[model samples]
Target: MPWYAPRHLEEALALLAERPGLIPIAGGTDVMVDGNAGAAGREYLSLAGVANLRGVSETPLGLAIGALTTMTEIGRHPLVCRHLPALAASARVTGAVAIQNRATLGGNIMNASPAADNPPVLLAYGASVVLMSAMGSRHVPYAQFHSGYKETIRRPTEILGEVIVPFPPDHAHHYFRKVGTRRAQAISKVGLAAVLAGRPGSWECVRFGLASVAATPILACALAAAITGSDHSVPRDEELAEALGRDIAARDDIRSTADYRRRVAINLVREALAPWRSQGGFDASH
Candidate 1:
């Protein structure tokens, strides 16, 4: 087995260019499992030494999170908690404290798990990823990243540079819910993240995202459209929830049944939007 650690991202990219099949490991939370199971390959590219890829800062586009930024860092960062509360919430519960301390945000993105917590929040926020290669950098919106199960649009030569989330509007509301099989260390059976803004009398347009409910994490555009401009009454909310459950595709899997998932998802939507309907604001800032 061979290991290479490059201090700079450019240097790492050059190494990757030279050795095309090397597996990149930032936080080994995911890779170590593969290695322990005799699945991780012989060649590994270590990203631990990359200094520039390990911080969170503000940019013109809301927040800029370096590729190697740890989930623990994201969970506690004031800017992240303030502007991206759902993301902060997701980061906090990713894998408990020790895992959060070492697992990187890029690791989650690159891992591309349908049960992952991060992607739904990114989708809800309409975040973009910065991909860099020997050629140049390009920003890809989160929705376009995943092509299939455990697959992404990341080319072999490119590395995720940073995650960019546009600043949320002043009145925006956010909701995130993750339902796992058990109470602890369980994978998500269903998860939902939503961002919406409304006034006292009208239901505003929204963005809804979810994971573990489909082949890939998804932005529930159809569901959002169904609820947009609808009244805040309970009957209408329940009707829309039922309609959304019907429209979404859910399948029975080892962790849970499709019927259970669909039912829970609809209920979760109601629970998440309760505050929005009752108080005319999000509970995050309340």
Candidate 2:
């Protein structure tokens, strides 16, 4: 198996164009695992030498996170922590310290696992992925990027460049929760990310994202709308929980049953929403 390590984006694209089957390797975390199991075979195109595809930078619109940025970098980035705490939280929960240091954001997305932590947070943040190919470049919304399990919109000749997370003004509150066999180094049975804006007096806007409960990481618009329109002061906790459970289409899996996951998701949402209620309204600082 041959490996090509190009130093520039254009050179990398040229190599990809020349060999369409060349798998792009960033952190090599997932690739090594799959390769060991004879899943990805031996040939690969290493992105390590691609200087352009690393680091997290601030853009005029928001933030541009390069594909090679490690999970550890995302977890520790002050901008990420301040702007998208849910993303930071998710990054912190991905594997352990050693894995976090080597697992790249692009690898996580390209893996397309239902339990991948970053997708839900990205969906909640309304992020978009920048993909480049010999043909050109295009942006795909995070919600639309994943087609199904182990599948994405990326083409054979394309590589994920960066993730663009738009800035949100006004008061914003984010909540993230995950359930698994144990706390550390465990794959999620279910995970959720929620973002709410506006004062508690009025639920102006809301976004909900979830993983391991659907075909792909999803934005629960119906659930968000339902919560936003309802009376904030009403003590209908059980009803709200029930509503969220109904909106999620969880299915049975080896890790757990669909009913259990749905119930847990409902409880998690209720707990996540509790903070806003306690403040008498949403706090801008929180």
Candidate 3:
């Protein structure tokens, strides 16, 4: 019922340390939705005024995307677009323009929704999260951040400080697709985000991340191995299907059926890999 608005990051961290149950609100996009539904009864710690947590910066490791950076900023920022185009694409497709203006990278991850658009992209790019507390900060690999559905490794005492996206190889292939009821503002029925290095065959590195098909946005390690090990040839559909079976854990949900999601996920992978199968290699011009 009470609201705590802090103008500084240190002040916010102190408040969180003193009141472990304080719910942090940045964009308030999700929190307001919960409040409107009579579900958000707890006091809110507003981080809107914490200006330090709201921009993008370069770091020795890669790009340091401040936690409070709005989806719209991410989508339009030249740095993000050049280095992590899939992330930029995911941000552009997250919600309508208004929602994108308010929704933030930190809030999205902290919400820990299995169908969230950005997590799969983060996973695919081998990103890391910087979680800060009054004590200090720690980095958690994005792939290991989500432990289960609607849950994350972020501690109650810690605030997500920033997301660190490592630079991919210059010739890397990036792909992202989200299937939902409609294009913008709809929750994803299934989504895939991937970063591939080297050619289709003789692949040097591969990371495929899928959403709405597992307890968490998952790295399809088994599927990646199957494709990467295919001896410079296109993998058969059966092989792809079997690897997908080992990777995803889709189930019947209101938006789609387990069978439908499975089939669609495989098809999406095939479509993304079509460049590999036909072009001899990724064509950057397209």
Each prediction's Cα lDDT score?
0.83, 0.83, 0.90
Best by TM-score: 3
Instruction: Give candidate 2 misplaced runs (Cα > 4 Å).
Output: 35-42, 200-204, 231-235, 238-247, 283-286
Identify the candidate with maximal lDDT.
3
Candidate 3 Cα misplacement greater than 4 A, ranges: 35-41, 200-202, 282-286
Candidate 3 structure quality by residue, lDDT tens digits, 1-286: 6889999999999999999888899998898887443345677789999869999988899999999999999999999999999999999998899999999999999999999999999999999999999999999999889988899998898999999999988888889999999887799999999888776555666889999998888999999899878776768999999998999999999999999999999999998888777766554533
- In candidate 2 the C-alpha lDDT for residue 238 amounts to 75
lDDT of 2 by residue, 189-229 (tens): 99999887765447655778888998787787767766766
| Alpha-carbon lDDT of model 1 | 0.83
lDDT value for model 2: 0.83
Name the better of 2 and 3 by TM-score: 3
Instruction: Write the residue-wise lDDT of candidate 1 on 1-286 in tens digits.
Output: 5788888888999988888777888899998887453354668889989879888899987799998999999999999999999999989889878899999999999999989989989998999999988778999998999998899999887888899998877678888889996655678999899887764345443788888888888888767766764555434766766667755678898998998988888887787778766876542355
Which is the winner by lDDT between candidate 2 and candidate 3? 3
List the candidates' TM-scores in order.
Answer: 0.91, 0.91, 0.95
Native-to-model Cα distance after best TM-score fit, residue 32 in candidate 1, in Å: 1.4
Q: Judge candidate 2 at residue 277 and give its lDDT.
A: 71
